[model samples]
Target: MAGEVGKPNGSGGLGFKGSQIPHIKFTKLFINGEFVDAVRGRTFETIDPRTGEVIAMIAEGDKEDVDLAVKAAREAFDHGRWPRMSGYERSRILMKFADLIDENIEELAALDTVDAGKLFSWGKTVDIPHGAALLRYYAGAADKIHGEVLKMSGEYQGITLLEPIGVVGAIIPWNFPTNILFMKLAPALAAGCTIIIKPAEQTPLSALFYANLAKQAGIPDGVVNVITGYGPTAGAAICSHMDIDSVSFTGSTEVGRLVMQAAAASNLKTVSLELGGKSPIIIFNDADVDKAAELALLGVVHNKGEICVASSRVFVQEGIYEELEKKLVEKAKAWTVGDPFDPTTNHGPQVDKKQFEKILSYIEHGKVEGATLLTGGKPVGTKGYYIQPTIFADVKDDMTIARDEIFGPVMALMKFKTVEEAIQRANSTRYGLAAGIVTKDLNIANTVSRSIRAGIIWINCYFAFDSDCPYGGYKGSGFGRDLGLDALHKYLQVKSVVTPIYNSPWL
Candidate 1:
């Protein structure tokens, strides 16, 4: 599916469902509300994961490039109309921005479908639309930002001001490009903060498209900027830049630590991170075995198991362990893996070749650790980065596959003798991002939900996410929250004002 951009079924373009590829534009660095080339005149190739071919050449932004973006954001936050504008005005512009997104949803979805290897159907139906919804949600919240007056003990009056934390730097992941991009960007804009976004280089195409739409929506110059580059260069510059007031990152825990350290060593800027996970989905004896198996299968297999909260660790009670395992194997074997544009394809290739090799290595680790390979454990097709929906049984808590975040289509099935055992095993991992509890008995669900140390728990289901719900991690999965009002606060700071009650000192 590689051919020229405008030419159908020709060289350098990726055709989906026999349709021509969307025109690629705005591949330059977005700074000060304009598309410009990098200072160093450097460029990098963004590959199509579906075919492992170069899709387009993106402007490579490194330290010098990040400096330019940060400088623009800083100026905008300090003196531009964006920060000083009324919340209602900002809300109006954001609504317009979201509308533009809706109008061009097809092109944006198509860019992600080829560049990131995301399913085209899901991108149109859920991922891109959810981004628009999130913007609207935060737009509605813009005007409602307020602070409460405080009562003082010693004849003094007090109040707190919730103000924008200037110059945010958001580093988003590749797996869910459209969804996670807005997940970090929406609230920051709604809070009246200027931002510089460093999208994952593996999926930089869609971010560039959004930058164009931001300009079209009449967002002020320098209010939103995007730098498409590698993590070690552009991502590091965002974290350590002294002008950036706060940083929000969504990626691996290893990179999360680097962000924190850079922020601390430079200016001690505020940091919020949503990192990796080794989530567990506990299916007990009381639950329907077949239903639990399907949920567990989809939980890990969705996005080719590239989600941060993929429930790769499955713990089933002994009474239903064999049945659930059998069902998991059968369903995983039948799961479809193919082109993202194909209507019948439920799973696509990994984001890039590096991720593909990483997942395959972890599968090897699972075998070396003595876990039984129940079904599908190898790469699929001849080209691209496709892998079979792999499953392993009798997996122990300490096994490599169960311990690490593979971020691929792999599941580790384990047996738990009792409820206590399930809780213990689930909490064994260093990550506590998310978990699932499946049971017919309300008592078991309630008990396990409270017992788990993770940030969010789902009952009788998996991958249940919403905009209003605050989502974050409790342990090594990283800190701070995205979504809800909690996410808005990450881009805001508080200033308390105090005065004498009877008569102010100046008065």
Candidate 2:
């Protein structure tokens, strides 16, 4: 709190807005469950995408730092008292951690909004709060991890024991840093696994800040460590570290592949990747145009369309394509794109300048591929890297816009003739993280949901997520589910304990 600094508003006016809130500076790294300076004593500045100005300076962690953190985590997993604690006791501590997160939600949300340019309403009201809820849920789940008593045929008895998998490395993406980090960490922690967290460099402030809160929450030293640096360096180090027992990564498919390769090369660590998605949203003629348009807009345009399952590819029935397109275009235009601090602003700038350029390039590609630009083709505002919410029509299945994960505020609308064709087009992409279908017909909705080869199927809804639900995808979208009791299995190992009742007879 002492190093916090407030940013100026869009008018460059150092007025009430700037005075109300402040930016933050994180100059130390969290390792061994403590805030300490990096051993190498190096640091880097995090730039604000809106102003292209250095907002905060963070501890720059490299391979040496990664090793130190991993060693601490390994020591905790092997020799520390955490793994030896009762499941109930561990659950109590995790509940405490969740309470701490809720207590400091405002501070954490402010930091996230400043660092990542996400909407404060979302970060404060939704992301941080849900993150805490997940932690609490996992906390309650910790003690409830049950083993089985299996019946044996011979003179022997068998039982299965659920045990921790040891040190885990969780690499989270920039878009939803706190939410995703908590999603991975809560279950791993509840399962008695120590962790080394590598947050996206574009938005590392909140992750590091949350580490401080973890210490305050009674989590033991070395139980949770955060290293803030680029993916290729700190992230790669995490993946390849021999001491790490497993790796859980959420990022682009290309980078996800590297993470897997690194894990395989180092120790063949158990890896769970939640990679990219070219999620599709299909709208049928029977669907309500206004409702479909609303869900469609939320699918791609929400969170600046930076979500992995953004529903970048939208499939509309030809009977209602023109009507739906009009509604979608109008709905998109209604969303205000401006500074995240503005309470009324619906869309915010991309994470950084580079991502802004990449999104622009994709829009250009849409134009080149003959996808008629329906609305929003250019960047908005002069100060920040804000892009206008874009939508394209006449898109073919082969178009690059329809095939690739744009990871921006560009929605490519394609028309399909029949329900079968819609299902086929939705599942055509290499990714299958999520999909949405809008229809009033129960049979059509049920059929389409069953046919889509994605992890989550939304009916007349988009961007719906809950801590209790299972999430993750098949194919290029990556493997391993996150959230709910099912996620707990990923961080635990099943061991069969067998005993011979008639040892004398066998001998």
Which tens-of-lDDT digit does each residue in 1-507 have in candidate 1?
Answer: 112222222123443333345656657888887777888878899898888888878889999989988989899999999988899999999999899999978878898888888888898899999999999999999998888798877788899999999999999899988889998899999999999999999988888778878887889889999999999999999999999999999999999999999999999999998999999999999898889999999999999999999999999889988888889888998899999888799999999999999999999999998999988889999899999999998788888998999999999998889899999999999999999999999999999999999999999988889999999998999999999989999988899999877855632
lDDT of 2: 0.85
User: Which segments of candidate 2 are over 4 A away from where they belong?
Assistant: 1-25, 503-507
Q: Name the regions of candidate 1 deviating beyond 4 angstroms.
A: 1-20, 503-507
Give the Å shift of residue 11 in candidate 2: 25
Clashes by residue pair, model 2? 5-23, 6-22, 32-222
**TM-score to true structure, per model:** 0.96, 0.95
lDDT of 2 by residue, 35-112 (tens): 666677777777676666776667788999999899999999999978878889999888888888888777778767
Q: What is the number of residue pairs that collide in model 1?
A: 6
Cα lDDT for residue 396, candidate 1: 80
